[model samples]
Target: MSRRRRKSLPAEPVRCVIERLSHDGRGIAHQNGKTQFVDGALPGETVMAKVVGSRSKFDELRTLEVLEPVAERVTPPCEFADLCGGCSLQHMAGDAQIAFKEKTLREHFAHFGGIEPEHWEPPMRSPDLGYRRKARLGVRFVPKRDSVLVGFREKRNSFLTDIDRCVVMDPRIGDRITDLRAMLYTLQAHDSIAQVEVACGDDAAALVFRNMEPLGSADYERLVAFGKAHDLHIYLQPKGPDTVHRIWPEQGEERLSYRLDDFDLTLKFHPMDFTQVNAGINHKMVALAVEWLDVQPGERVLDLFCGLGNFTLPLARRAGQVVGVEGDDAMVVRGRENARLNDLDNVSFHGANLQGDFTGESWAREGFDKILIDPPRSGAEEVCEYLTAFGARRIVYVSCNPATLARDAGVLVAKGYRLVRAGVMDMFPHTTHVESIALFERK
Candidate 1:
């Protein structure tokens, strides 16, 4: 049997008047009675787009030329903005990007939750560029290109984008992309390096190289010298995250730590641990969560999906007692250690599958006057079922995905909670990924 060949993409450019922006930052237009999503085009703009993909419901196109530009459109700062998938909204003005995210949150609330917030808090803002403190960059050696690509994948493609610098990433690492590429080229196991995981703390930055094979002696020495010369903490992961160990400054603690000066607390974490990409936004976000929860001195609070006591310790400072629950045992342990390091006696952490049957957990039986939830992208559907039982008067939910947040908001509202306040956080600027926070109060 002969295999079928794929259909060729349309070579001709199609004119489109962008009606609106999709949640993922694509411009939506109707062409031939079907919706078309055009990349690199803003809402209220006329553009000529080339079809990259065609489907039954909608077609995907890349903007070839903008016939009419919107006021919000701006020249992208990064040279690789056209190809790099790291940032989708660089072409849109910073203020317009924030507005678009706020619009997205409002739309999700109305469509998925069947309700809207009574009060809209001002969208939290932060530095729009060079603010990313964490990232997992792909590294690929393509012989055809005759060079190793050390950056994010191309827009809507599997191939890595050949970029020398990323404006959105922390300048400490972003500025060294060329140097990193050069160093990798000099390594004997250059192709063996699969990824570079970056983690920046208040005072230092660390990079963990995920090596697919054992590094030669010279390669290892070169990595150490490079780390020393660049003033960076370096580590190698031979297999899994658990295998990540520091190679430079081999004497003291190599843990990366961020300080929350407002709370007088410091959180130390491993490079492989999950953390907010934007440290400034994270600090502000925690402050917002605490302010919204408004836990009184005698109040008991519950924090779900608590990682490294980011919220638990802060809440403990105000509330009488705070209980943090997380699924990862390592994270739970780390949270406890953070609490200990801060001398926070009122805060405790437990490990349990929050999305599964957590009814038997002892923490589930405790009454909470207020609660703070920061679940993963899947949202807290299963946990929402048990929230009402805790009799929490106020709940603050921090979400990375608006759709899931809206869905869970519906469940909470159905349980007699009112959507009191909600807003978006510019945690990830130049990207359509929305980080939102919402408050619900039992009426």
Candidate 2:
């Protein structure tokens, strides 16, 4: 058997009028009786787009010239917005971005779940720029350019974009991108450095370097010196995430922590731990989840996919008792430690895979009046069956992917739970990534 060859891209730029926006912020257009998804183009705009890829049903293009612009289109703040793939809707106005995300959530709910929310909560928002506290930067040494690039991948390409700064990232690390690039170029094992994982706390920032090769003594000294000068905590991971360890300022605190001032809670986590990238939105999101869940002082609450007790600890503050369950044992331990640190005795944590048959687990048999779920992109399909078994009267679902949330909503609705309220959160500004929350109550 032979595989069919992909069609070649057109050489000349084609003129097209963008009819609508796709879920990922790409503009939808039709040309030559086929659909074209153009990057950097907005709806109601006419542009010249260059074809870069071809598929059976559609072709992918990049806008080269915008002959007519739409009112929602604004100048991107980042200098490398055109080349960097870090953000998609940077050209769209901030207010319009929120509206677009809310619309996306609604569309997903109606199309996949076959229902609409009874109450539409106001969109949770935060600062548009310098809001990202966590990110993974691509590092590469290009011999042709005789320099090292330390930033995100280029748009529609795997190559690293030569960016000096990132507008969406927290300024503590964003402003140091050029310095990091220059530092990498000076290192002997520059080519061995594959990526940099950034994690920022309230007061300090940490960078974990994923190195493919061992560094020399001089290189180690230079990294330490750089960390000291910039007030950054540095870690090196020669292999997997478990191997990540701090090499600089070895005596002080290596843990990164953030505080929810309203709850008087401080949560500590490692550099590689799963956490919200936007700190501002996370603080607001937790408050909103607590409010919508309406956790009472006498109610028992269950928190699933709880990481470092971000929501679990806060829920414990309000509920009489809360049980936090996570898949990773390490996170469960951290969650317990966070509970202890906050001096909360009403919360406990357990490690169990929520995606599998969790009915045999000890926590599964417990009864609860309220439940909170914060699942990843895949959603909580496997665990929805057990909600009613716990005798949960109220459930609040915090979702990072709207499509999966909608699918699970259908399951809950079938199980006699009514979708009372739903809304989007601006966790990732200037990007199509949608984080949402919804409340469900027994009919």
Candidate 3:
């Protein structure tokens, strides 16, 4: 059988007026009943957009020229904002971005769950720029250019965005992009470097280089020297995540930690462990969830999908006991370690497949009156099935994906919980991703 040839997009830029915004931060335009998702075009804006990709139902486009500008549109701060995929909504004003996210959250709730929150909490915003603390940057050396490319991928393209500096990333790594590229270009294994994983704490920042092959002694020495000069921790991963090992300063400590000043607690984790990308937003988010859950002194709280005890340790300070359940045994150990470090005897960490039937587990049998969930983008639909059994009077859900959150909210409502308050968090500002929290009480 012969394969069908893909259709080519028109060459000339087409004029259109953006009708609204798509969930992914694209401008939605209708032309002859076919929708167009135009990048860099805000809602209510008239622009000439060039077609990039097309299909029978919808089309993809990029703004070539804006004939009319919208009130919310602003000059993007980053120079490479047009080419880099680091942030999609940088052109939209900060306040407008938050409003769009709030609108998206409400639409998700109404469309998916057929329910709305009784109250909408004011959005928690990050007050500063360059707040990102974690990222995985792609690294590649192009022989044709005889230079290295170090940054995020191009917008809507698989090719790496050849960017020198990033305004959204933390200064620790963002400011060093050009320097890193120069250093990598001088290394013998420059082409072998796959990517660099970045993680930062209040006092320290670390870079983990993923190498496809073994590095020469001179290259290894250079990487270590670079780390020493910058006062940054250096790690190397020759194969899988488990192969990540530190090389700089022969390190006294293998982990990085951030402090929750409000709670006077510090949590530590390995450089490769799961952590929030934005430290400031994370601190505020934990406090917000704790406040909404309303944990009493003698209450037992359950924190599902708890990683490294971010929320568990904090909640343990107020609740009589807090049980943190996670699927990864390594994180469970980390959670226990953090609890011990904090000297919180009331909190315990357990390892269990949250998607499976784990109510028979010893930790689940304890019965929690208050609950908190901070699941990944997949959300916690499977665990919602067992929430009613836990008999928790109040549940606080911190979600990264609004669609999944709305779906799980429906399940919670069906299980006798009413969504009382919900709001969006500017955890990842300038991006389309929405981090929201919802409070559900037993009806």
- Give the least accurate 10-residue stretch of model 3, judged by summed lDDT: 124-133
lDDT of 2: 0.92
lDDT for each candidate structure: 0.92, 0.92, 0.92
How many backbone clashes does every candidate have? Answer: 0, 0, 0
RMSD versus native structure for model 2 = 1.4
lDDT tens readout by residue for model 2, 31-108? 778999999999999999999999878999999999999899899999899889999899999999999999999999
Candidate 3 C-alpha RMSD relative to the actual structure: 1.1
| Model 2 worst lDDT window (10 residues) | 357-366
Residue-level lDDT for 22 in candidate 1 = 88
Off by over 4 Å in 1: none
**What residue pairs clash in candidate 3, if any at all?**
none
Candidate 1 clashing pairs, residues 3+ apart or interchain? none
lDDT of 3 at 44: 88
Tens digits of lDDT, candidate 1, 254-312: 68899988889999988888889999899999998999998899889999999988898
